[model samples]
Target chain A: MQPVLQWENVSFAYDGRFEINALSYVIEQGDFTLFFGPNGAGKTTLFKLAVGLLKPAIGRVVLGERPLSEWKTLEIAKYVAYLEQEAQYIFPFTVEEIVLMGRFPHTASQFWDRKEDLEVVAWAMEITGILRFAKRSIFQLSSGERRKVEIARALCQKPKILLLDEPTNFLDVRQQVELFETLERLNREERITIGVISHQLSLAKNFVKSAIFIQGGSVGSAGPPEAMLTPEKMSEFFGLNVSKVSVL
Target chain B: MNIMNASNSNVIARSPEGTTKQSQIQRLLRPQLGSRLAMTTGISPGKLVLIIVFFVAILFVTFLVSLLSGAAHVEWGTSEGQFILMQLRLPRTLLAFLVGMALSLAGAVFQALLRNPLADPHLLGVSAGGALGVVVGSGFLIAGSFVLAIPVLSLLGSLAAVMVVYRFSLRKGALSLYTLLLIGVVMNSLFISVIVLVQSLVRSDELTTVLFWLLGNLSFASYPRLFAISVIIFTAAWFLLRQARKLNILSFGESTAHSLGVPIERTKKIIFLVASLLTGIAVSMSGMIGFVGLIVPHLARLLFGSDYRKLLPTSAVLGGIVLILSDSLARVIVIPQELPVGVVTAFLGAPFFIYLLKRQEAKRVI
Candidate 1:
């Protein structure tokens, strides 16, 4: 498979401090990759760079062999869907309405949702298991349900590559597994590239095909999960004894 | 289909086609609450039509009532009555309606732009800026005789306020809503102080005029002035309606909006400029009328949904209705001695604001 997202010698800094330094990684089509590191190791920042929320100070971010800077925001959004760590909405938009917003990149210039857009939203909601609560207010739902609504929204984007930042952050263990399983299905069945930044190392190891361990704003190692997430590598990257890392 | 099999554990017999069929049947069985059309426009065309018609009729009735009942009852057939209706009452009522429409639309826009329910045109220092402009602009003129200069100067003042508030609140390339709100509070207090200082320096003979104007009066509106202001208000209203979808997306917060391909910075700037123009022009036309902007949009949101497409127009019409009714009450409430319409609005609006806060507090518990 061809590379769907490539970060070539990418570097980024915030307020005179480096958050990412000369990092290079490639996520090929239909690849399910997990990025994990200690807090503030710039996993989230790497996602930001991939989505062009932040521009790399050095080198380039490329999608489909084209430089990211050459694409408009709408075009980039169509190709890659980015889900932030938190979901915030000020108004009482319905679950369906919020998910329908995922079709925005496609229907931005239109005054209203088209028939095809509605169908896609319905299909998206169905896959994400949120069709039952389609008419309910997002604020009324539990946190796990809300996360599904967010995933449903991302699915509606019909993206080639999906980047989720801590999709399982607030979820219980069961919910986290269910979310990852759904994501794995998308990666396999829909053939969409998936990159996720997560802390659930032991849990995520079951779903992800490959792993990229980040340390001190750089890629410490990347390979198949079995090799890359060994106890030796975990201790080195997280600065903890393998026995103390219970989550792993 | 495979994902559904792997993850969905519910006993409900379902397939992709089954879900589609169920939704189709549900759509048929469901009572139409205008939601079919609301799917795209936020409000159904039929409901919007009915609402517009109902409000238009109410607005017409209020116009006639205000035209005939104020202090002096004027017969429709008599020439003297015709003179009072056409010359004095008609312009006043129309101006009130226009000002109401402008303020309410501006308020709705501000609330959405700031993502705060409490946001209003007056809260952002635009009205205060206009008031300061009027006080200072009129000071340079031969006190009570300058009609045109008041509006010109007030518009300039408000635009300047918009510039300052917008400039200072911007960070790098994006707007910081937190900073924007704080700067608005600061600018309002600072501008109000300048207005009071200007008020102190005025001649005693001119003091009452400035004070009455400051308290908000619609008696100064004439046919020519109304005609000029109406063009601007309508144009701005049309522009706002076109921006409904962007505003809807913006309610999700700037970062999400950006990820969804919305140029949040550009949208915010355009909305800010247009909303400020509406507020500035309303203030210039009729001194500083408070509460109409704050109260009308909230009432509209309650009556209608929060969709900007529906909310903006509804707020405009409802605003016109509220202001017309309030102006009429101000005319006849005490007979022969007119109360400033602003006082009546504040009197009505403050209680409602308190009620809203109480309701919100109650909602938070849930």
Candidate 2:
């Protein structure tokens, strides 16, 4: 089978200043790919392109052998779910209502949420351990809890691929561990393709199968995490000291 | 390894309990039958019941007061009283109700679409459009024919103003709420100036009619005009209610609505068109009744939640009742001479509006 996601020589720019040069990468089925870069390295922009939210200035984004432009957004939504970094709740919707919105593409009409839709939402919530907060207003939830609810909403779509942008940001240490563990379990058990953009190298090293290091809007290295994430490469790309120390 | 197995077994054993607890919680969280019934029509049962009872009571009292307490001071159930009630009070009451429903419903839709608590039909240039039309129509008014010219010109003017605002405010196929509001304010000011210029140019005799119309009197409301306005208001209300779900999604913000497959452009167009029509019709029927639209929707939101399903219908019904009571008081307050219904609405609604604002601030602070 073709790679679950492919970015071929993609280029993007915003307002003519910050630009992402020609970039190419492939994410195989069931791969936990971590995209590592500093702030403004076009991490969010790349995710946006992958999810078809933004069109590349050059080249193309392909999913399951189909070009991003060719697939209807609702159809694409069935295969890929995007969790934005900011989990802002603009309306006073309950947690259940927000989760049910994930099933909107599958809903027959705007008026009703069917039994199957509720069941899927319930399952997603259960997996995220947010089933107990179903009736709580999203605005009332803590940042970590709201992020979990957002992930639950993405999972409710039953997408084959998940794209997350800084999912660990604003989360407590325990919450971060819980989220990473959840992602690991989902990837291993469900065989879901996952792409995450993160600055946390330690967490990324533990979870991701591969790494793509981006610097100055261009790929620095793309290979197996163990081989690509060396001390010298880390120092060169991030301009930081790299040292390993025993925990105990 | 033994401890891991034991913990794993504990997790498996606790699964049924968790499921049972969730089901129980779900049952408790489910809305009651009364709430469900309320939700079906897009308003809470408690508010609906209160509105229905208030409407009936207000209607009866206003009708009785309007007939008995006018300049004629006609006794209840007498021949003169019956004639006044049938000929004047009844039509005025119907006009008040229709205008109130139209303005309030329009206001609710405006607030939802703009996502601003301060939005109202009058604030968005529709009232000024109607006022300009009425002022222009006054120039063509023949003796005893002011009624025909007023509604026709008012409706035309309102439609024209709305079209101008909408055309100018749209950018890249989307209406920017801020631009729309700014254009509305400017257009309204320009239209008001034109109305003033027209009022100055009219003959002294026509000036009284124009001034009364501008002040928004329902004293001239006939049975036929009342019937026409009633039909228009009810039709507009039904159209808005049908689009309630779209409004609900819209309140969540445009991008989210679009992602959920709601055609944002089409929905906005339909809402703006229908809401403008309702405002125009209301303004044409009763000259520039302010604050009913501005205040009633907020009141409804406070009484019920911000859910449009409940918000729209409740606003409409409560709006009608508020106008009826206001109109009745307008007629009876001075006894010999009546006050303008617009003045009454502003007088009553402004205080209620302030109270609501303070309450909202208090809620936010807490």
Report, for every candidate in turn, its global Cα lDDT versus the true structure: 0.82, 0.76
What digit string (tens of lDDT, one per residue) describes model 1 on residues B96-127?
Answer: 99999999999988887898877888888988
**Deviation of model 1 at A26, angstroms:** 1.3
User: How many residue pairs clash in all the candidates, one count each?
Assistant: 0, 3
Tens digit of per-residue lDDT, candidate 1, span A135-211: 77776887788888988888878899999999898888889988998899899978889999998888899899999
DockQ score of each predicted structure, in the order shown: 0.41, 0.22
- For model 2, residues B1-366, the per-residue Cα lDDT tens digits are 444443443343335433666545544433331132123222235655786787677667655665555667667779987887788777877778788889999998988788776788888898899888777766666757876778888889998899999999998777877788899989999999887887677656766776787777777788888878778778878878777767866765665455444556788888988999999988888888889999998888777656676678878878887887888888778877889888999888889888888875665510
Candidate 2 accuracy as TM-score: 0.77
Task: Report fnat, model 2.
Answer: 0.08
Q: Which candidate is the best by lDDT?
A: 1
Best prediction by DockQ: 1
